[model samples]
Target chain A: MDAREDRGQQDISGIYRMYSKEVYQYLYHFIGSREAAEDLTQEVFVRVIKSLHRFEERSSMRTWILHIAKHVAIDEYRKKRLQTIFAGTLLKLLPSTEGLPEKELQDKEERTHFEKALLQLKPKYRNVIVLRGIREYTVKETAEILGCTEAKVKVDFHRAMKMVKEVALHIYEKGAGVNEIS
Target chain B: MKFPSDEEVLQEFRNRPDAVPRSEFLHTLERKLVEVEQQHRSRSKMRRTTIRLGLSAAVLLAVFFLAPIFTRLITHPESIMTTKPEAPLVLKGQQLKLAEVSPAVKQTLEKLFNLVPELKTMEPKVIGKEDGVYEIVFYQKEQGKEQRYVSVEMVAATGKISNYENEKAMNEEAPSPTEEEAKQMSAAFLQALLGDEFKQYQVSQNANNDWSSVAYTRYENGLPVFLDRYYVGVNSKGVTYVNTPEGAQPPVSSEAFPKPGTFLSEEEVIAKVASLIELTYSLEKDTGKPLLTYSLETTGYFHAETGEDVESVSSHTSRYSDVISVKPGGKKLAARDADEVAKVMAEEFGIDMNGVSFEADERILPDKKGVEGTLYKSSGGTEKIMVYTNNKELTGFQIRGKIETASSTQHDNKPANAKLTYEEAKEKAVQFLEPYLDSSVKELKIDESQIMMPTSTAYSFSFFALHDGVVVTDQNYLVNVDGQTGQIVNFMDNFMKPIGPFPDLDTAISREEAVKQFLQSHPVELGYILPVEKETLQLRPLPVYSVDTRAYFLLDAISGKLVK
Candidate 1:
C-alpha cells in the first residue's frame, strides 16, 4: 500500500480501538441483541473508513463516530426486521435471576426490566437515554451525536428517565403476570 | 409504587452486562478494511488509466475534426454549451424494514407469535415504500386442526399499530372481552410499545361490542395533553388496531409551563382573546350562504407571561383567507391571455402549464378592492399560482412541487463582485417591496433574515405583515435576494385581503370584561404547557401547565361572548 493509504489504515485502527466498545454497547442496548450489535459495529467502522476523509470536523470525532454508529444501527434495523422479532424470544430464554441473594436477584430483575422498557421506547427517546443517561454524555455532546439542540437533548433525557422509572416500577409491582397477548 | 430516581435508573442500566464484541471481531474488521483499501486503489488506478487514454484519443481526433466542429460551435454556441438543469429537491420516500419502522411494531408481532406459537410456522412478509410505515401479512396456515391468518398495518411515524385483521373464523361461544377488559388489554399493548409512562394514557371506550374502539389521551399534572391521542380497536379475536400521531410521546417535564405565578385572571385572558378576535364570513358549500364566523385571531400557543399568544415559528400561510375560489366563478379570461401568463411561468419557473385548465375568481384585495385573477392548478394539485387579469400581476401562488432547477438568470451566472453586505441585501429587499407597502401595511418589520452560504450565497428575508397596529397573525411575505447582484431570487406575499368595512378598534369590549366572561365558562385544568420552537428535525417536548385548564377560545369583541 502507498504511504498515505498506510497512514489512513493506522488512523482507522486507532479510531476502532478507542470507540468500538462504546459503539457496540450503545447499539446493543438499542437493538437488544448482541449479535446484531456486533454486526452493526463492523458496518459502522466500514462507514467511518469510507467517510473519514470527508468529515469536516463539524463535531468532535467521538460524536461523529457515534452519529455514524447510530445511522448504521438504524439501517441494520431496517434490513433485519425479522431478526428483531426473535430478539425478545431469545432474551426471554435467558436464565432467570436465580441462585443469587433475594435483593441481588430483585436488582437484576429490575435492571432487566428497565432494559426491556428501553427497547420498548421510541428510537429517538432510546437514543437520548443511551447517550445521556447510560453513557452519561453531556447534553451538548448527546445533541451533537443526535443532531439536535442541547435543550431538546435535555428534555428527551428527562422524559426517557421518567419512562424508564415508570416501566421499571410497573414491572416490579406487577411481576410477570402482566397480560401477554394470546 | 414509587418511581426510581434518575441516578438509580442510570445505575441500573450501568449494572447491566456490557456487550463486548467477539475477540476476533477486530481481526476480521482489519482484514475487511485491507480488502476495501485494495479494491478502492485498483478502481482509482483503472479510472486514471481510462481518463489518460481517453484524453490522448480525444486530442488526436480533435486535431483531425476541428474545422467542422469549430464552425458548428461558432454557428450555434447555445446548442453545445447549454447548462444542465438542476434536479428537483424532492423528499423521496425511503425503503424501510419493519424493525426500522418501529420497535413497538416488531415487539407486538413477536409477542403475538409467542402467544400463538403455531403462527410462527407461517413466515410474515412486511411490505412498504415509506420510511415510517409498513404492512405485514401472515397467510392462513393449517396447524394440526386450526387455520389462522393475520395482517397488521403499522405506522412507525406514530409508533402505533394502524390496523390488524384476523381472517379466520372462531367459535361464537367464545365471546369478546368486555369494555373494561378491552381497556386493560389496550393499555398493556400500549405499555409494550410506549413504556410505563404511557400508563398515563387513560383509555375511554367509545363502543363495546364485537368491534370496539378505545381512545387514549395522556393526563399530566391532572390536565390532559389533548395535542396527541391514540385509538385502540378490539375485536372478538383480540386487540385489532391502534392509531397514534407521529412521534407521539408523553410530556417529559412536569415543571409547570409558564411557571405558576399570577397569570392573567380568566377575565383578563378572555379580554385579550376577545380583543384579538376577527369577524369573518364563510360561504356555505351547498347554499352559497355567507355565514358570519368569529375567528380567534390568536397565533401560536397561549403564553402565560404576556397573557397573549406567541407567534408560531412554522410558516402556515395558505390557511387564512377571506375569498377562496369556491366554484371557479368570474369573467373568464381568453385562452391566449392565460397562455401568455402561463408562458412566463413555464419559461421563468420551469412550470409546465401546457394543456392545464384555468379558472378566474374575484379577489377582494385591500389595496385594489376587487380584482379578478386567473388560477392555474397543476394536475398533481400541488402547484397553484394566481395572476391578476387587469394588471397581469402575480397575486397568490403556492408551489408544493420540488424545485427542479435554478429558474432565474441572476442565479445562473456568478458575478465576481456579487458579495453584498447584510445592509445592502436589506436595502435591496426594501426596494423590491416598496411598491406593496401601502397605508394598510402596518408595522412592516423584518421577522427574520439569514445569509445561507452554499454553492450560491443568498440572503432570505421574512417580513411580517401587520394590520392597523396589531400583528396580522396569518399574513407575511418572504423574499430572497442574490448575495452578489442584489436581485430578487424568490418572493411570496401571503397577506390576505380583508373584506371590510373594517370594525372600529375603539368599539371593542374591555379586556377585563372579556376575561371575566371567559373564566366563568372555561374552568382551569392543570396540565403541562410547552412553548413551540422553530421547525427542527428533532422531536420536541410539549409544554405542561399546573392549575391551567389549557383551554383557549376566541370571543367576539363586540359581544364579549365565545366565538363558535
Candidate 2:
C-alpha cells in the first residue's frame, strides 16, 4: 500500500543468500543425514522469511538465523525420537549404505567415527557437539543459540565429549562400525 | 581400537562430506521466497482496500463486480494475479491472507504470458524466486490423459529466460519440426527470450543430441567456449524444454582469456609428438585374433603456449639410495638362499621368525629370484609379510593384512576414526618403515606430489630410493597408510639390493642409431589423448598430442634394441 515499501523492498532471497549455508552446515552435523538436513535447512529459511519483519537489531543476523536453525534441529530430533519406535532398532540391523549410489555410498563411507559416535549421543549432547565441536562455535554463541548460559554450554560440551569416547569404545568392542552403533 | 584425541574427532566432524546445501535446494527455496513476497504484497493490498471500503458488505459487492474480470482471467488472463501453492500461506499472529504478485514479479509474468499466449489458460503461477528471478509453472491437464505441462522461469532483474517447457507438445504424438527447422526455431526462441544477449552465442556444430534438440555455445574472445554450451529442445508446439544450466560462474575478464595466437593450434601440438609408426599387432577380444596395427608411444600434454608436448606428470622426486662412497661387495649373486635371506630379514629388517614359517615360492613373475613367503603364526595366519631378495641382497618386502584385498571397501582403506591428516599419516608411515631401512639403500623420499588423493582413503606414499641423490627410478618402496587407523597396513619395496658393482650405462650405439633401429620395428604413432594425471583428483580436460606406449617398452640401454 505504501510507495516506500514498493520502492526499496527487502525480500527473503537476500537473507537466504547470506545465511542459508551457515544454517545448512549447522543442521547437517546435528542431524547426521544430509537429506533430512536439507529439508530442515529449507524449513529454517522459510521460518526466517515469515519472521524477517519481526527481526530486531538487538542480535547479529547470524545469531538470529542460527537461533531459528537450532529450533528446527531440535524439532527434527523430537520427530525422529517419536519415529524411533519402528525406525530405531530396525535401522541398526540394516546397513545404512545398503542401497545408496556408489558416489553417495563412498561419501557416507568417509564420515569419521564422530558421526557414528554422535549417533550414540542423546539429543542434548548432539546439540552441544554439533555447535561447539563440529561447527566450532564459541561458548557465548552456543549459549545464545541454545538459550542457555555460557557456563552451561561449556559443561554440557565437556560431558558430551566423554560420552563420545565411551560410545566409540563400545562400538569398537561390539565390532559394529562406529557408523552403525545406534 | 584406539580412539583419537577430541581435536581429531572434531576435525572428522568438520571434514564430513555433503556439508553444503545442494544448489537445486537453494533454487527451490528461492522460488518459495518469491511466492511469499507476491503473497505478502497481495494480502497487504487486499487489507488496504477492505479497510477503505469500510464494511464486509462493501467487500462482497467489490468481489461481485470483479467476478467478470476473474472469469476472463481464468480463460485468457489479459490481466492476471499469481498466488501461493498448496494451502493458503496465512500465518498466525500475522493475520495475513491473499497476496498480490510483487510489481517486478507481475511484470515478468505478464511479459511471459504475452510472449506465449498458450500460457494464459495454463494457470501460470510463479512457484519459485531468487534475487527477483521468478520461476513460474503453467499447465492444464490434457482433457483425459495424465497431466502434461510447461514452465517459464523468468529472470526479472536481467530479463533472461531460462527455459520454456511444454509437456503437452512433447508427450502428444503431434506433427514435429525437422532437425533443421527445429534448429531455426531454437535459435529464434533464444533470440526472443534473451533479446540482445542472443548475439553473444552461436549454434554449436557438436550437436550430438537427438534431432529435436539444438545446442548453442557462448563465445568469449571471439572463440566459442564449448564448455558453456546450452541446449534447447523444440517440437511442433514451439519449444518443449530448454536445458538451461544453473549456478553462476566467477566472471573472468576478457584479458584473462588468451587471444587466438597466444596458444598452440591442435595441428601444431599433434605435430610435436608425431613419429614414424612401426607395425604392431593388437589382439581382438571378441575373436581372440591379432590385428596388425602401427604403433608409437609416449605420454604427454600439448602445452597451450608452446604448441609442444609437455611430458605427463609422474614421480619427479630424486630417489633415495646409498651414497657413492659405498661400494658393492663383489660379483652378483645368482643362486637363491632362504636361510641367509631370513637371517637378513630378521637382523636388518627386524622381522621375527620365532613363530613364522618361510616357504620358497618361485611362481611370482618378472623377478628371476624366487620369493621367500613368510607366513605369520608358523602353522598359518592371514597376516603375513613376504620378503624378496637377489641372493643375500634384499630386493623388496610386502605386508598383507587379513582381508586387505584391492576391491575390499571395509575398514581396509576407509579412514578410521583415528583421523590422520596427510602429515600425520606420513609420520606414522615413516615410523612403521624406520626399522626396515638398511645401509645400502639411501634415505626414502616420499613422492609428495603423488600422495593420498583421488583415493579419498589410504595415504599411498611412493618412497623412491636414490643413489648419490640421483633417482634410481627402478628402486623405490611403497608404503600405504591405512586411511582409518593411521596404521601401515601395506608396504612393498621394489629396490633390488645391488649385489655387484654398478655398470657404466654407455650404449653400444648412438641415440640416432637407437631411434632408427627402434622405428624399424615399431614406428611412431602420434595421436591426441587425455593423459590423466593421477596426482590430482580431477582429470585435466585438455587433450594433449602424445604417444600412448602403455603396452610397449622402449629400447634396452645396453644393447639398443626394442624390449617389447
Candidate 3:
C-alpha cells in the first residue's frame, strides 16, 4: 500500500509486459517442450522481479533478461533429466505423437528430429546456435548474452553451424524422407 | 549426396514450427507474480517487527534500572560532586568496578553527553579498560518500537573518543541513502566529531557495500599512513555509526614534507609502467577457449627519498603453474620417462595418481611453452608438471594445482635487505633458465626487472624469448632470484607452442595515441600514499595515483578495441 511498494509493483508489471512473450518464446525453442517452457518462463520472471534492482546497464535489458532465462531453462533441463531416469515408467504413460493423424505424423517426426539434433549438441554450441542462428542475435549481442569476447562468439558460431550442418545431413541420410528445403 | 550448406541448415532450424504456450498461461503467471510479491513483503515486514520487539525489551530493562539512579542524583546534588575525582587512576594492578571509571574516561563521556543531551537519560555504563582504552555502553528506547545501544571507546592516553558503535533495529521500509549522500553524511559526521583534525583525513567511499559506508584515512602532510583510519557506517534508518581505531594522532608538522617536483617525471613513470606491461591470455568463461589480453600490474610504491619505484612484495614467477617440492622418498633416481617423473612427483607431493594417465614420449612442459622437458599432464591439464633436460636429467619439478579464481591476495610487505646487486640477480636468473633455451633464440633480452624487498629479498627478472631479432610478445620467461644466496627461487617460462605468424605492427596506433586512449578510459584517482617500509619514519608527503590494474587493458593496435 506504500508508495515505494506501489512503484515496485508497477516496475514488475512493466517488465512483464515488455519481456514476457519474448522470454517465453526463447524458453520454448530452448527446452523443446511447451509445458516445461511455460513453467520455466514463470520461474525466470520470478527471478527477474527479485533481481531487477541488481541489473547493471552494461548490457541491454533484453540481453539481461534472456541471460536469466537461459540459466532457468538449463536448470530445468538438468532437473528433468534426473526425473526421466528415476520415473521412466511414469513418463511412458504420457501421450505419444504416434497417435496423431498420418499427415501430421510426418511433420511431427521431422520436427522431433530437428529438436533431437539440437539437444544432442553440447550446451556451449547449442547456446551460440540458439542465440545467433535461431534467435538471430548479432555477434556483439550474442557475446554479451554469452559473457564472452566477440571473437570467441564468432568462432563458436562458425563451429556450431558446421556441426549443425553435419548433424542435419546425417539425419537426412537416415531415410527420414525430409525434403532439402534449401 | 551433397551435404546442406551451413546457411541452409541454420534456416531450416530457425524456421521450425514454434511451440506456443496455452492462452491462459500469461494470466496465471501475472496472478502468481502478485502472490509471490505479497509473500516476500510479508516476510520482510515480519523480520523487521521481530527485531524491533527484541530491541524494545532490552531498552525497557535499561530504563527500569536507570530510573532509580536518576532520582537519587536529583535528590542529592552533592553525590555528583563527590563522584568526581581529580587524580589520575592507574589500572595496572587493582581490580576496578564498572562504576569506578577513570576521571579521564568520565570527562570524555560527559563531553559526549553535552553534545547529545538526549543520551544522558540512558545511564551509560563503563564496561572495562581494554588495550588502554575504556569502553562505555549506553541504552535507550525510541518511539516504543526501536531500541538503541551506543558504545564508545575512550582512549586513556589522549582522553579522545576513538570509536562509536550504535546497535539498533533498522526500519526495513526506510529508503536507503544514495552513495553520494552517504559519503557527504560520513564526512559531515567525522568533521563534527574530530573538529580541526578532520582536515587531515581524506574520505574514501567503499565500492562493495550496499550501505555505502565511507572510510577516512589520516594523511600526514600529504602522505596517508596505513596505521590511522576511521570507518563510518550509515544504515537505512539514517543512524550513523563511527569507528575510529586507536593510535591515530594528528601530524606534528608539515614543513619537512617532500614536494611533487622532486619525484619522477610523469613521462618517466609512464615509460617505466609501459616497460612492465606484458601480454597474457585467459580462457573464455563459457567456451574455455583462450583469449589474448594484456596486463601491467605491480605491488609496489614509489620511494619518497630516492624517487625510484620499490616493489613491496616479490612478483610471482609462474603463469599457469604452481610449484611444490616432491620428496624422492630417500631414493636417488633418474627421471627417464613420463612414468618415472609422475612416480617421483606423486610420491613427493603425496598425491594419488593411480588411475591418472600421462604422455611419456611427448617432451613438453605444460607451464613452459617450447621448453623441451619430460612433461606429465593430468587429465584436466590442471595438475602435475615435472621438468627434465633433453638427456632426461631431472632439473626442475612442479605440481600444477587448482586455478586461482580470486582476484588478488593481500601480502603484508615486511622489509628486508637487498644484499645482491641487479647484475648478480640477473646472472642467477639467466643461469636458471639456460636449460630451457633453444638454439633458435638469438638473444636473451632482460625486458623488465625489479628488486623486491618483502620479508625475503628477491629480484624478479623478465626475459623476452626472442627468436632471430624481433621480440616474441607471447613468449616470456620469468625468474625470481634470492638476494642473499644468489639462488633461483622461482622460474616460469610462458612460451606457448604453435606460435602464430607475427602480425604487422605497421598499422598499429602510435604509442602516444595508445597512452591517450588508456588515460581517457581509466582516469587516475588519488590513493593513500603510505610508507614503503613500516620501520621507515617521516615519509615525505607526495600525491600518488593508484591505478586499478584489474581494470587496465591494452587496446588492439589496429582495431582500437580492448585486447584483453
Candidate 4:
C-alpha cells in the first residue's frame, strides 16, 4: 500500500465516523438491537469498500454510499426471511404456548396478527415502507438512496402503505380483536 | 377520511428524511476498501512466495516448524516470539463449581432470600470485553413486589467474589425481619455468596445425583435449632460467592440493623399530592370544579410501651377521609369509614367489632378554620390525622381560595417554626446522608433555593458526588422541625445532576443557531408548545427538529424523552 492509498483510506474513514451513527440508526429501525445494527452497518461498509473502486463520480458520494446501503439492506432482508421460515416451522411444532395458558393464547394471537401484516408486504414495497415508515427515511432521500426517482419512490411507498392498511382493515372486518368474530 | 396524499407524504419524507448518513458513510466504505486491498496484497504475496519456493515442499516444512508458533501467536500474541504458552489459569484457594454446590446451600438461599427458582442453571455474565471474569446475578421482589435483580460478580481469574449489589436497596424501604429471621436470611445470603462451602453440608440427594447441604447455626434469637440442608452451586466459576462459610461456621457480625424510613416527608408528601392532583386536574381539565378523590394511606407504626394506638407513625397522608382507630407499627392499615374503624378495632384489639367503635374527630384549626385535625389515641399509641376542607369556609370570605390557602388553613395549630436555612438545610441533609453518600462525593450542591408557601418558605436542595465507580445524586431532604412541638412541616430534595446542559439560547442568532449549538448540527424545526418548564437541574430540553423525514424530539425534559 502506498501513501495515496493511505490518503484515500483516511478520507473514507473520515466519512464513516460522520455517518456511522445515522446509518446505524437506519439499520436499527429495520432490524432492532444495537449489536445487529452495528453488524449490518459493518457489512454495508464492506460492500461499499468492494464497490468503491467501481464508483464513478456519476452520483454524489452520499448517493453512492446509500446505493450500497440499499443493497446491503436487501441482503439482510433475504437472510431474515430465511430465518423467519425456520423459526416459524420450529415455533409451530413447539407446545403451542408455553405457560399461563390463557395469557399465552392471547399473546400468540396478537403476535400472529402482527407477523401476518408484516409478511403480507411485497419485497419491493416492503423495502420502501420499511425505509419510509420504520427507518424514517424521507421519500426523496430514500429514492436517491435506492437509485429511483423521487416520484417513483412516492408511488411505491403509498402503494405499500395501502397494502398495510388493507390488511389492517380486513383484519378489523374479520373481527380479530375484541367484539370481532374470530 | 382520506389518508395523506402521496405527494403530501413525499413532502413529509423530503422534509424529515430517514436517519440515513448524509456524507460520513463513505469512511466505512473506504476502510473496507483498504482492508480488502490488504487481503489481496497478502494473498498475492503468499502466491508469489509459493511459486518461487516450490509450494508443496515449502508448505509442509513451514507447517512442521511454525504450527505451534502460529497457535501461540494467535492465543498469546505477546508470547509468540518470546516464550512458550503459559499454563491455563488455575483458580486455587476456595474455588468451586456448580456441580459441587450442595442441597444445604440451595435450601439456605431459598429460605433466606427467596431467590429466583432458576438458580441451578444460572450462569454469570462476563463484564469487560478483555477480561474472562464472570459475575452471578440473582433477583428478588422489592416494594410493591417489583422484581429487583442483584449481581454477585466473581472474578474468574482470581476465584474471588468481586462485588455484591442489592439493586433496589437504594430506592425502596428494606423489609424488616425479626432477629431470628434476619439471622437466617443473612446466613442464607452468605451461603449463596460462598457457593461451594455452603453446598458441603447437604443431607439430601436428588434424582440427577445432585445433593444439598444443611449447616446449622443458633438463630439470632439464640433458640436451639436442629436442621441440616443442602446447598446448590451457581456455576463453573464460583468465586462470586465469597461470604459463605467453609463448614458450619456462623457469621461474626450480629450488629443490630437500623429500621428503614420512608423517602417522603411533609413537603414531599405535599409535593407528591400536588403532582397527583395536577395530573387528575389535567385529565379532567374540561370538567369545571371536578371533585378529585383519592385514598390517604399510612404504613409502618412504631411500637409504644402502652401498646394502644402504635407510636411514631412512619408515614401518613390526608387523601382519604378515614378515621384513625388504632396504630400498631407494622403492616399499613387504614380506616376510611365506620365499617373500616370497626374492622380495625376487631383486628387490633382482638375483640369482635360491635358495629363502628370510633368516631371521626372534627377539630377545625382556630387560626385556619378550613383545615381540620383528627387526632386519635389509644392505650397503645397516638395517631395524628389532618384533613383539608375544600369548601370556602377557611379564610372567612369567599375569595376563590388558592391551593396554598388550603395548606395554610390545615395546620393552624402547628405554629411557625425556625429550622435549617438553605445552607444549613443542605448541611443537615448531607449529614443525614452519611451512610449512603459515596466516597467520591465532594460536597452538596443546593440545586433549588426558594419555594413559595402561604405560611412558610419551602426550599429544595440537591446533593451530588461522583463515587463508587459511578455518579451519585439523590434527593437530600430536610425541613423545619417545629422548635415548640417538633412537627415536621415542610421538606425538599429533588437534586440530581442535570442530564447534560441546555445550550445558551441567546448565543444563537436564529432558530438554526440554537439547534446547531445544542444538537451538534442535526436538522431543526419548530417544536410544539411544551407545558413543563425546564427544571434548573435538568439537561437541555430535547431538540425538536426535522431531520428531513421524521417529526421527532424528546418529550420529557428530565430524561430526554425522544418521541421515537
**Model 3 off-target regions past 4 Å?**
A1-182, B1-174, B178-188, B199-211, B214-231, B239-396, B399-433, B438-494, B504-508, B524-539, B543-550
Q: Global lDDT for candidate 2? A: 0.51
Better of 2 and 4 by lDDT: 2
- Predicted candidate 3 versus true structure: per-residue lDDT over B1-564, tens digit per residue: 444455445544543333334435776787788788777656655764775576577546756765674454333322111212223343322334445776655665666665557677776655433445566667676678334467666655455566676554232345666555666667676766665556656666443234336777765434564435777766555545666532333233334334444554567556555544444433332233434434454543444334344433222222322221121122233667767766755664345576554444231222222234544333323443334333464444333332211101121111136578867776666655664654444465564423221114456666665433434545566666656656554455454433444444555555555555555555434433434445433333444554434232555555556542
True contacts kept of each: 0.27, 0.39, 0.24, 0.07
What's the fnat for candidate 4, on a 0 to 1 scale? 0.07
- Give me the displacement of residue B20 in model 1, in angstroms: 61
Task: Judge the docking of candidate 1 as incorrect, acceptable, medium or high.
Answer: incorrect
For B328-420, candidate 2 gives per-residue lDDT tens digits of 222222224656655655665456656454544322222232433222111133345555554345555554443222322222334434478
Better of 3 and 4 by TM-score: 3
Backbone collision count in every prediction?
17, 25, 1, 52
Best by DockQ: 2
Locate the minimum summed-lDDT window of 10 residues in model 1 chain A. Answer: A173-182
lDDT score at residue B416, model 3, on the 0-100 scale: 37
lDDT of 3 by residue, A82-128 (tens): 22331233223223655445543453344445555565566677788
- lDDT per model vs. reference: 0.52, 0.51, 0.53, 0.35
The DockQ value obtained for model 3 is: 0.10
What are the iRMS values of all candidates?
A: 26.0, 21.9, 17.9, 26.8
List runs of model 2 lying over 4 Å from the truth.
Answer: A1-182, B1-176, B208-210, B244-421, B427-485, B489-564
lDDT minimum window of 10 residues, candidate 3 chain B:
B404-413
